[model samples]
Target: MTQREKAKQPIEADVVVVGGGPAGINAAIAAGRLGARTVLIERYGFVGGMSTAALVYPWMTFHTVEGKQVIGGIADELVRRLQAIGASPGHVRDTVGFVNTITPYHPEVYKTLAVDMLHEAGVKLIAHSFVDSVAMEGDRIAAVRLTSKSGRLEVRGKVFVDTSGDADLAYLSGAPTLQGRDEDGRTQPMTMKFRMRGVDLAKVKQYMLDNPDEFYRKTPIDELESLPLSGVMGFFKQWNAAQLPINRDQVLFFTGPEPDEVLVNTTRVQGLDGTDVEDLTEAEHLGRKQAQQVADFMIRELPGFERASLSQVGAQIGIRETRRIVGRYTLEAADVVEGRRFDDVIARSGYPIDIHDPSGKGVAASWVKGDGAYDIPYRCLLPQRVNNLLVGGRCISTSHEALATTRLTPSCMATGQAAGAAAALAAEQGLAPGELDVRLLQEALRAEGALLV
Candidate 1:
């Protein structure tokens, strides 16, 4: 390779998506299915970002307040296909609540399914590649420089979608972003999810119904000190204000094909900045150590976990909060509480305003009752000054309060699909994403099986 050849070579595509998780995968697939040459770049080798790589099983809130399926398109198809292959467990139709309408999948199985979906859609996948910087031409993004084992390279696109969850590309492109809340600007805590094997599922359930207190008292985990997992069990009651009642026998375990396995979602690593590489690196090490300790405590202290062993740890530490792009409109907490609707609403979310304490040990979630659900305006996904850039996933424009509700995977997928579709239309019409016709974009989204109301 000569000196001229060593210069960052540019690879062009119609749409270039950053991040290969649910949001990125759906975005790339949607764009490709729409006849756009899409290139998806991921830091890891897998396709499903959080769901697969982070081992975050069981996507939350895929339905509406009226018990109707709200998240459709590629999101619905991905779940259905995984279920057919025994990768995901079948959902209990209209179960106890809206959150229960969707099913949880095995993380490993989900990874396989996501890769298959991308392949079928003809999306060019470049895994193990990290997007380092954005190349701008005037007001629009011209290309993005990525670094991998093969060295530095550039991927140029007409329209760019920031699905990195951290909003790396968007921020590097000089887009204004809000991290966490305004008062102190503290990001939510990070978690390291792990799975345990040899759990006695029946005993776990019995313990929750029988001796909830005894379970909390015996478990050494800090989150179970007062408010524990048991508090989240009541059918209609909200566990937001009160402390979660601890599940002595791990009653909240996900029931997958492996009877002995139990997924643990409890490692709360706090005070670490997701944007800081040093902080993130420390958080990962600390999270893994804590996960092992929790696993050991399960076997030693908990009744049903006497023989339980650590099965697997999450590939990436689960980052709860990060950058919130300052878009044309920012969804506020008041909007969420009032269930505000917008004329240009692209999707709706009913999940509670769950603000995980910066302490990372416990959550400060507030539930909305009655018909309390908010519409996510299309503007929140579009940056104010940027012309061709769109943001999806956890980094969308929202107030500190509203970001919590919109951070979930299902909602992220919804925003990602819409953003991708909008980007494709903008490129095909030779217009900026912000200048694209809203009504036409909405119609296209609906036609592509997206649930937009």
Candidate 2:
């Protein structure tokens, strides 16, 4: 800790991406592929932020409402590689006539794949690095200060992508942000996902069919009673009619992973601010205890769990919503519900508006049927009042109601790629992200195999 060291200058790069989640990973990779000296800083040791570390397995929608694969480039390549390794299967047809793509891979697989991709792409990765503050020059982000094992350091970049999910970099850089809803800004409940081993697939399916209401009733849980698994039977019937296999005892239920085995998603703990370290720590403590209670109940009450064993629990609690950067154009619920299209659209999302209540007893979801896809304008990815900064993932600008749908991983990936590509192009050509030609950016994205409409 010499005086010279204390005053050392920050490392500089062409593009710097904070947060190593799906959005950040894709953004960094895209920037690097476009020949930018990209640097990706992550708080955790590994990449794939939520999907791998938090164990949010199974990417939701990769296709448009018409069942055509709309996501490509690194995102699709990763999925294809994982599928080749048997980490995931093909898409599952849902009762609502949508294909739900689930990747039931070990979380470690995602970590490995993500690292391999980043290494091959030549992006410098600094792990165990937590971004603390943003150094700004008026509307432009100058540098980002990070705390790591080595010491506190600063990373300066020409272009910065705020993929921190909570809009940490953007918020600190003086960009306006919206957190949760209302003055208190309450976020959705966080869940701990775990998996169960030796689940009798047959018995689980049967319980859903034969005892729909009773099965949900006897689940021995209160926070999820409002979710009503009994109603899922109708969905199962649709699957059965479509010639999908219906197993009775094999219930991959969402009871929240607990102990050593079950993936629990039932902790309804709320009122904790994800950006606050103390609040997050307390939430983790309560979440772990609640996970244990869920596991115990599943083993004792659920029919297919007579001999089922808990296999693994999530490494991190799955956070649903957080700080959203106020972008140039905030997508709203009306836009999503009406299936609006945009000429400047860079990506589209078809997932439902699934908003988990803070109380954790019920979930609010709006499902769309038949060609109900909404365009994500490029403006939503650009943070307002920032010249060289952009945002993606759950933190992108959108109305509170619209965020319920746009926060999914696939949508995050699409926007991440767009933002990354946009940043690289802007830096390479000495233009601000907002100043870049939309048609040129779109051309570059399409050249990189991104699906844009």
Candidate 3:
């Protein structure tokens, strides 16, 4: 059939979630379980998004530095499911001193389990579909256009939840959005994660002990020896000596469920806009080239990687920052650092402000004050100018500095859970997301085991 001749196939749902990443996955699940007819569209064949596609490993910390679990509900449930199947070792100590705990799992296993959960929740999955445009009725998104195997289709929904980490849905709907840092529109660097197997971790630990000053400053030898599986982020002397082209002052790798495997998150492609196709293409090329360089350096220099082989490279480069919607209320940097509470809080995160340098090497991070948790207000999910739409993930309303903390995997999942529940509630009540009662949303989230104070 001719492209123009083909009819726009229509699918109807109460909540239509775009992007099947960690945020979208939880959003669809929460909405579906809340009795909303949920539809989740993914660009790829699988649903794990960054977790499976980009190989962003060891879901960085669901807890505060004090070991208080700030994220629960669907996020925790996913981990428990993985544990039940022996596909994950669950949360382990962060010997790198970056976070309280890092949850590591097998990427393929994560893909399978995520799909299973979505099906169990009765969320209709549309894989290999890319959202091309949006049909709007005044300020509300009437439907989203999708190009999939069945040909061009239109999905109509009462409420739309954008979990497209890049804010593709909100941006396409003509909503005013913020991109990158405020000063120059430059985003945090993109990383291409790679994995290596056949590593001798014992020798690696011995080297860290012998050269105590070579690793992360906060991590002590005692904590390093406490866990058999720990995230490692040092070997500065070797990294400096090798003079690798890859950016960053130190090398970072994390142990996984596999004894001999380590996920390498070292390659950085700075000064690239993840939203731009050309930039994404260039980033993909540069990131892969840099990944090869890092793997070679590890094998030749690191004590544990003498026999390690580059087993896998990420299907896509890991994007840290992108387009953020200008919602009803923007989360400020101080709110994150001071652990500010909100009267309409829907989600909470203890993960620190971790900014991967936009145009330079290294990262700048600041921890949250008090118990190390801060509120993600419900208003952050309600993008201005859009009546029936809610957003989750890194794209939610936040300043550039605050985005640094909310961009983590666990934080994204938390906001996603909020967005999904809010979408369901709004659809049921026949009201705009802004008109929906924040208290009702909070009650729903709490019943699902979400931690919101």
lDDT of 2 by residue, 1-453 (tens): 775586365788999999999999999988988899999999998888888777775577776555666667667777778778876444543221223433344467778888888888789999999998888888898899998877888999999999989999888888899988765688887766666676554465465555454332323224233322211212233223333121221223432212223344444567788878898898777767766655565676666677886666677777888899889999988788777889998888777777777654456667655466888999999988889998978899998778988888888988998888889999999888999888987887788778775
Better of 1 and 3 by TM-score: 3
| Alpha carbon lDDT of each predicted model | 0.76, 0.74, 0.91
Would you estimate the TM-scores of all the predictions?
0.88, 0.86, 0.98
Candidate 2 vs 3: which has more TM-score: 3
**Sort by lDDT, best first: what order?**
3, 1, 2
lDDT of 2 at 188: 80
- Per-residue CA lDDT of model 3 for 204-247, tens digit only, reads 99888788899888765775666674778889889999988877
Clash number by candidate, in order: 6, 30, 0
Error of 1 at 101 (Å): 3.3
lDDT of 3: 0.91
The local lDDT score (0 to 100) that residue 235 gets in candidate 1 is 14
**Candidate 2 stretches greater than 4 Å from native:** 1-9, 64-66, 94-99, 212-262
The full ranking of all candidates by TM-score, starting with the best, is 3, 1, 2
Off by more than 4 A, model 1: 1-9, 93-98, 212-253, 369-372
